[model samples]
Target: MVKSVAAPQAKGKSAEDKIFGANNRAVALSEKLGADKVINGTVGSMLDEDGNLIMLDVVQKAYKALTPKEIVAYAPIQGYPDYLEAAIDQCFGESRPEGYIRACATSGGSGVLHHVIHNYSEWGDEVLTSDWHWGAYGSMCNDNGRKLREFELLTPDGHFNMESFKANVSDMVAKQYNTVIIMNSPANNPTGYGLSDSEWDEVLAFLKDVVKGKDKNIIFVSDVAYLDYSGEKHECRKFFKKFGNMPDNVLIVVAYTCSKGFTMYGQRMGAMICVTPNKDIADEFVAINQYTSRATWSNSNSAAMKVMANICKDPAKVAELDAERAKYFHLIQERADLFMKEADECGLKYLRYISGFFITIPMEGSQKVCDELEKENIFLVPLGKGIRLAVCSVSKKKIHGLAAKIKSTLDAVGAKQ
Candidate 1:
């Protein structure tokens, strides 16, 4: 027998991350067959029309302008005072909710998820999210000794399934009394669906009713990593105003990231902000999350924090950044439009794609479909229920004829959509 010293929980842990696996395969094929003949859509990062990664010019300039000290120094465990305010401002925009708000730096949007899971939930507790969610949510919960429960994201008619959501929340609250829900919207990963303003109202109203007389705590985490690329700037954020005046037991945590918005992917800069009707809760959010930061990552990237602080402080810089991002936004939109149009014509079934980096095709045998597509030099992420196409990285040229090919593959495999 082999000797081992790993803890039970840590033993036999290996990551076979399908996303990276697919990307690696695509790269190997590209090297053999040449890049021009391959359609690589595995990663969720913006790419130019020529298949080169896009880093916003304005953000690049800002980083290049940073002093050596700014790049090398350690940021505060919580964050710089100005960067915290900038995070709140960037997250809320004009739809600032009426609440006692506070923020702390994080590694990225993923770090925000980690801190929320650690701080808001009890060990062995069940956390809630939509069924068609980013896969990392499950990993994070499992790593922290929490179970993840999911509600159906869409009804058969392609609308938000409030019934499923309410039922799931009720079940979770009954079991744990303290429920933590993570909602990724405005550009949900794997699927581009976003809840409407009315849907937002319904969700908040239902939650308000759930905790009416019961002594319960609800922590709602809005993972807005793709908010900047979702749609019209202020229009996409209008739902945030509804967070105001929420029940004291209902706390709102906004996970904001500069990855997509500022094209700062590798910089690993983001913040987790709390909004509460009670000032005490807001203060406690800062204290606890800051302490968690120290215990975990220690601090975030100082240069990235300073870049955001500088950008947020100047109106001109903000305008320039927005303008530059809009160009790529429209570029991605055009690519999505091309694929969606072709999908419609070819009878390709996909999740309701409003706007975002990825579009998921709901199917029974996604891994098989993706495997077949890979043979044709087309690589995509295979989720449990479907294949995710990263329109953010695929240019319009490559997007052409892509949906029809996928539909044909599904048909060949007799996969149900």
Candidate 2:
């Protein structure tokens, strides 16, 4: 008989409301710089002009001639079988390492990272990576309640720091966490540094020593996203063979992406590879990874799988795609070279490693500099340590002008300070 008591409305913001959502650096820079027609190197977005669109048509025609599937149905949770096989073949190439290799299709390189962290690592576990890394590494790990640990990334000679790497691995082992070490090699992101064979030997030696007698479980996840753009294919992939007869406690996961290699950013195709000395481990990895994929994405894009499968299966089409990829790779290198040269002429102090589609400019007040550059119709990503400049999408004509713009911005800002 009594009137229903009305529930009090919430007085304050929810937890989601408290959280900062937008990328403030990118957003502020975009706004101050006038986002409308600014040239961008922030995200790895490739803008295909009329010419590039025409090239895509030619590639599509080749694909149709080979495997002409009109409609694409849902792919298996694990992925298209033929597509997975071709991806593995393309990665390993002629030199197949002696290990039990299994792969699972992922949304993209970042998707593979998400699956590995969510499925394999426990809450509050630690992941060790380079101090300077792709920003998303921290975002993904923190979202999953995992702690990211880092060590200094370079030596005095501007090479990979094996000593610092060993120290960090040994510390993680001491903490008794199921350690996951992600090595973004052969042109690491942000900095663009690769490990030499001797450097690899040192790191491997440390791993062998750390997990020598203990039953500790260690996973090495190699992010080889920029493999094709490294100038030398076989030389860059040599690290994969080193783990051929790896220890039972140690497993290798290769996160391979088609975004850079195949220029299929919209397709969102990639793979999570598990390499182990035992077939049983490989089987277990596949089963658990499939569960992770189901719980999250459920299934991958069918059209992407179909197109990739068609291209991989046809030898002539594969050759043609490779040639096309090489053309872009060379263009990226040319742009990077020109930008570096311009930076040198301007007396800019940048990180000395350059091997990929991007480079980090070591300027003070990177955010302010980025903002100033945006006013001039130029855009770049600002990192905690430095500013990341992508030289891939911009034209050769834009390279020198962009460098000059950056120099001017820095000078003006410096004078104000």
Best candidate, TM-score-wise? 1
**C-alpha RMSD of candidate 1:** 1.1
Query: Model 2 clash tally?
Result: 1
lDDT of each: 0.91, 0.75
Q: Report the error of model 1 at residue 155, Å.
A: 0.9
Show how many residue pairs clash in every candidate, following the order shown. 0, 1
lDDT of 1 by residue, 150-251 (tens): 999999878899999999998888878689999999899978889999999999999888888888989999999999998888899899999999989999
Best candidate (score: lDDT) = 1
Model 1 is weakest, by summed lDDT over 10 consecutive residues, at 10-19
Candidate 2, residues 242-287, lDDT tens digits: the string is: 7787787888898988777776776788999888999999999999
Report the Cα lDDT for residue 241, model 2. Answer: 80
Clashing pairs in 1: none
